[model samples]
Target chain A: MGITGLFLISFLMVHCFLNSLIFINDGGETFNLGAEFMAKNWVIRAMEIVLFGGLLWHIIQAAVLTRENKKARPVAYAASNPSANSKWYSRSMGLLGTILLIFLIIHLRHFWVVSRFTDEITSGKETLFNEMKEVFSQLWVVILYCLAMVSLGYHLLHGFKSAFQTLGWNHVKYNSMIEKIGVIISIVLPVLFAAMPIAIYMGLIK
Target chain B: MSGNMNLTLKVWRQKNKNAEGKLVNYQVKDISPDMSFLEMIDVLNEQLIVKGDEPIAFDHDCREGICGMCSLYINGRPHGPKDRITTCQLHMRSFEDGQTITIEPWRAASFPIVKDLVVDRSAFDRIIASGGYVSVNTGNAQDANSLPIGKEDADLSFAAAACIGCGACVAACKNASAMLFVSAKVSQLALLPQGQPERYLRVHNMVAKMDEEGFGNCTNTGACEAECPKGISLSNIARLNRDFFVAGIASDN
Candidate 1:
């Protein structure tokens, strides 16, 4: 889980940086070039397979772990005060992941499916940049993107440090630093990702 | 008398392991504020005995917090609402005059219910038996200064050893994972030179045994640390994971 999770984390950084080209605000010309490079570059094209594999591996591992965990306690506590001990998001990883899965499907339908299957972008009939403006132009899509980022933020907040702890990389001296960095990554990545849709919807990134 | 509590108790009553258990209500009046929670239960049991009813059967010994034998999930929190004390150490003064206290045994599949308020925690014993010890030649005691140890390592080992093998970590965990308990046992030994001979073997075997015993996987929820009566740190768990991974690669068998 930790290995795959770290892989996915790194993927998000790349994805975030690549997508941030929209902030160039040049009517998607720069963003389209970046997207074109991502599509035509053989290295990235190959990595897309590994990225999907990592995501599937993570989801499957979570499902199995959650199942075994549920089986450990057949009889639920009649009353439990879990809030006294752990954070709500820490305990709700499965739920947050489910939400992300739904969000991913919607996101893929909006862009990945269009670009890969429909040939709209490859045929020069449409550019990936215009696709973003068209997609984020809707209020509902922007709101949905924002909500998904919130979920991603909370998920990463617990996941980042949790992966380190699982890998046994903890130290008295470095633990606080890891935790602090986790908080920063959780906040910054989601905020940056969310800002894109909001920026586009508000006509700031045309 | 003015400060004494008259509280309602909803105690779980089960005849035996296979019998169905239910929360049966009983009233105990004029309980002294100084009485421990178990002592309060003793009062209630005494009342049941006078009335020719079956007294509540619960496991307890050494009434101090060290025994780890007193396993009660009181009012949702393990060992009651207190932060770092067992049920035996929990005084009745923590409650109000009319507060209704609900008590139940630890709920986990691996730890079966032996009777009311008593679950079989022998699973933990089995996990310990697997590899919680170091192999030493049966000979004269070694010189005390022969194996010089650093203070930080010694303190960390002592802190890890403070785990009383209470099942609160399992009960408090939403997943019923025994990671904290097993990790504490593993950490205590891994930090010392005395435990160096079988360090990799101990971790490898113990973790395998723990998985065989059907404890859940840890999700790093931090509930175990929060509810642990002995304040066992989660760092021990991190150590366990680290050692286990190393053992998987390094251990020959």
Candidate 2:
């Protein structure tokens, strides 16, 4: 879970950075160039396979772990005050991961399918940036993206530090540093991803 | 400092390990505010015994709280609402006069209920048997100054040693994980020079035993530390993880 989680986290960094190119405000020229490179580059295409593998593994591990954990206590507590001890998000990783999985399906359908399978971009009929603008044009799509980003933010907040601990990288001397880095990644990455759709919808990024 | 008052009690009653458990309500009158939580239960038990009723079966020993024998989940919190104390250490004063207090046994697949409020925590004993020990020779007592151990390591080991093998960490955990208990044992021994000869073997065998015992994995939720009666720190868990990983890679066996 930790290995795959950190793998996906790194993927998010690259994805967020590439998508943020739209803020160049050059009528999508820069963003489209980057998107075209990502789609056509053989190395990127190969890494995409590994990326999907990591994602699938992370999801499957989560499902298996959740099931095993549930089985560890067949009898539920009649009344448990879990919040008194731990953070809400720390205990809700499975729920947050499920939400992110649902969002991933929607997101892949919105952009990835069109870019990979369809000839719209390849035939010069449409560009990836124009697709983004068209997609964000709908208020509901924009709202869903924002909500998904919120879920992503909370998920990463716990996941980043948790992965370190699971891998035995945690120690008293460097724990604060690791946690600070986790906090930064959790906040910055999701905010950037969310900002893209909102920027397009509000005409801040044309 | 108030006078004794009446209170309602909802205690879990299970005839045996195979029998179904339920919360049976009973009213206790004029319970002293100064009494310990277990003492309150003793009052109810006396009432039940006098009336020809089966008394609640619970675990208790060394009421001053050193013994990990007492296990009770009171009012949704393990060891009651107070922090860093066993159920035996919780006084009636922490609760209200007319409150409805709920009592329960530790619930976990690894720690099955033997009766009403007594669970079979022998799983912990097995885990300890697997690796929680040193294989040093026991001759005449070695000089304490021979080791020349650092104070920080000694303090850390002492803190980890404070774990009483009580399953409160498991009861409070959402996953019913024994990581805190296992980690405490690992940390206590791994920090000492006498524990070095079998360090890798200890962590390796202990973790394997823990997994085999059907305890859940630790997700680092921090519940175990928060509810631990001895105030065991989460750093012990980190140490366990570190030693476990290094053992995986470094151990010849």
Question: Which has the greatest DockQ?
Answer: 1
lDDT tens readout by residue for model 1, B20-136: 899999999999999999999999999999999999999899999999999899989999999988899999999999999889899988889988988999999999999999788
Q: For model 2, how does the per-residue alpha-carbon lDDT over B26-76 read when each residue is reduced to its tens digit?
A: 999888888998999999999999999999999999999999999988888
Clashing pairs in 2: none
Candidate 1 chain B lDDT trough over 10 residues, lowest sum? B137-146
Which residue pairs in model 1 clash with each other? none
Interface RMSD of each: 0.6, 0.9
Predicted structure 1, TM vs. truth:
0.98
Model 2 chain B poorest 10 in a row by lDDT: B138-147
B34, model 1: CA deviation in Å? Answer: 1.2
TM-score of chain A of each: 0.98, 0.98
Q: Which stretches of candidate 1 lie over 4 Å from their true place?
A: B138-142
Chain A TM-score, candidate 1?
0.98
lDDT of 1 by residue, A34-92 (tens): 99999999999999999999999999999999999999999888767889999999999
The global Cα lDDT (0 to 1) of model 1 is: 0.93
Per-residue lDDT over A1-206 for candidate 2, one digit per residue giving the tens place of the 0 to 100 score = 89999999999999999889998999999988899899889999999999999999998898888888999999987877888889999999999988888999999999999988999999999999999999999999999999999999999999999898888887788999999999999899989998998999999986
CA lDDT of B67 in candidate 1?
A: 91
